[model samples]
Target: MPHNSIPVIETKRLVLRGPEAGDYPDFRATFSSYRSRFMGGPLTPYETWMLYAAEIGHWQIRGYGMWMIHDRTTDKPLGMAGGWKPAQWPEAEIAWIIWPETAGHGYALEATHAARGYLYGRLGWEGAVSYLDPKNLDSIRLAERLGAKKDTGAQTVDGNDICYRHPSPAQLKNTQISDGIELEIAHYADPKFRPEGYALD
Candidate 1:
């Protein structure tokens, strides 16, 4: 494969890399369905494009954004996982989405572990949180699976968006990624793939 400007992160069975046009169709389908209710979605086509473009644009503006999660065996895009920080947010957030077909396969849980590790290891972030709608039980459970705790003191958008703070840098000082996870984050990552001026290793 050719070199990617964005760093490619590998886990046990998936590849996390930059988003592209091929990922849009699946994304649109989710955002158009009830599955997206917690994400302020069920958006119109115009709104979907805007949200999709913003996700891609976030990488340009912030140097770190969501990665398209692809199955290593099939190389087919399954979902997305990574970080996002808009201007209004108090801190960056770890985010993920597993397509309907991949639901219950533990893909989001696995992909998120890699993404969170990347944020702390390569991105040089001191902390991060995952914001979810109060009713987004799936996301809340995922956050809990990642060892995140509900941060009631954190600020939210529109007095909503329950915040789940991930394991802090100090908390994950050791045992960051799971034992079964094989990360290509450091040794195989691009030397130039620094996020916001932070080195990969």
Candidate 2:
């Protein structure tokens, strides 16, 4: 199986797919700008390059990683959302990032919902968490909107970040997400690319 054989998720207005070479420049610009402040950014060009490789490499090493979000019709790159966990992290996380220019359209929320559904329905995760900077109020609100609550008891990946635990699968089933988005996750029951649940190796 390809390292990034990750599923493609479609929302009402967005489409999330595996990362590609074309995605680097947009990611590079966003990551190097003030927009990526909360994500430990304003990084050097070399660091940006390495991080891009690492994100793609994540799928190779961990079997699950962030997917690039795009406009459904224009196919324009928006941002990224999905599960993430590094060796030093205490737990797996469902992370999201949307460019500041595209901030107001609720793209992050829609992509995140699709990502959460994949984590539960396809990957069989018991639950998920999102680690955020305490100052990132937008993400905090988005987390809450997605039915995630602050988990003061949970350990953070970095000393500065805070944890927000997402609702359980049963709880998620009870809450209504965006209307009319058919999140038909691809490759169901296909083991060629088994997503080893969000366990840190």
Candidate 3:
């Protein structure tokens, strides 16, 4: 399907969809938490909603934007993971951030892997990019696991400017990964993207 025509995606334990007005409070809470400290200072509910609305608006204008990730069972939001084209980056950036309480559960990686595949596989994009802070070990590791290279070049945006890249598959194959977890990019635009028992609030 065309990129713009893609619908919500469902994963083993999550659901990926466009942002809604209802997401403001959750997003505000997530942004204020310690997990998101590196993402810039906390934003007010209105600011959070504005940012989210802009993301949703991207789908209409750019045919791509951030997709909110939520738990399928409890219907709680984990965070957002998908394609974004912020002005600072030269190419479309693949980004994801889980709420503080939800950290270390592999949600970011899972959501990101699926989003990347959708970008390259479904959207037919030539390539994708991810700009990360080198000191943010979690994000760095996640990017590496996805086979994304470190560009070394930095461009400041939202108080951060650091390594960036579009990693090759060979790079991914060469990396050693531990057991018990595997990454898959969530494709939100696919019709089959819904997780079991998922419902929008």
Pick the TM-score winner.
2
Model with the higher lDDT, candidate 1 or 2: 2
Off-target runs (Cα >4 Å) in candidate 1 are 1-4, 175-201
Q: Give the TM-score of candidate 1.
A: 0.84
lDDT of 2 by residue, 78-155 (tens): 899999988988888999998766765567777888898998999899998999999988889888877789999998
Model 3: per-residue lDDT, tens digit, 63-101? 877888888899888888888886656667888888777
lDDT of 2: 0.81
All models: lDDT? Answer: 0.78, 0.81, 0.67
**Segments of candidate 3 deviating more than 4 angstroms:** 1-6, 153-160, 168-201
lDDT of 1 at 121: 88
Overall local distance difference test of candidate 3: 0.67
User: How does candidate 3 fare on TM-score?
Assistant: 0.74
Candidate 1 lDDT trough over 10 residues, lowest sum: 192-201
Q: Give candidates' CA RMSD values in order.
A: 9.3, 9.6, 7.6
Q: Provide the lDDT at 6 for model 1.
A: 78
